[model samples]
Target: MDTQKLTIRLPESDVQFIKRFAEEHKTTVTEMIRRYLKQLQAQHIDEADAALQSITGLLPQNITEADTRRLYADYMMDKHR
Candidate 1:
């Protein structure tokens, strides 16, 4: 993979905080940022997969056409909360 250099500017206070955190963890600031991004992406993928599974399970297999439509409409309007 090809790598490019990019510079980012943060407030002095934010930089100090990140520097302290990275020092305590014995890791670089870049690694800490990368780990945080990966965690966020993983959480997003899991949520998307769960929503897809739930919607797929709602598909009708042996119901009449009219009943299927009604069921889907109700599912859309009904809030779990």
Candidate 2:
């Protein structure tokens, strides 16, 4: 795959820390950043999936027209109370 170059400015302390971390891990800072980004993306996907799962069964299926009307009526009544 083709790759592009990116330039970023960091504080001297951060740069030193990243260099030490990369040396300790036997990986380049670029690879470390890429791994971190992948982790962040995975975390977001997990959170979104959890949110969708939480609402999956909030409403019942197989409701008739009468049931729908009754549900709406109850909602309106509760809203006004």
What's model 2's TM-score? 0.74
Tens digits of per-residue lDDT for model 1 on 9-60?
9999999999999999999988898899899999999999999988885655
Worst 10-residue lDDT window for candidate 2 reads 56-65
Please report the candidate that would top TM-score against the real structure. 2
* TM-score of each prediction: 0.66, 0.74
Give me the displacement of residue 75 in model 1, in angstroms.
13
Task: In angstroms, give how far residue 61 of model 1 lies from its true place.
Answer: 4.7
- Where model 2 places Cα greater than 4 Å from the true spot, the runs are 64-74
Candidate 1, RMSD to the unseen true structure: 5.5
Summing lDDT over every window of 10 consecutive residues in candidate 1, give the lowest-scoring window. 54-63
Task: For residues 1-81, write the lDDT of model 2, one tens digit per residue.
Answer: 687899999999999999999999999999999899999999999999999999997778887889989999999999999
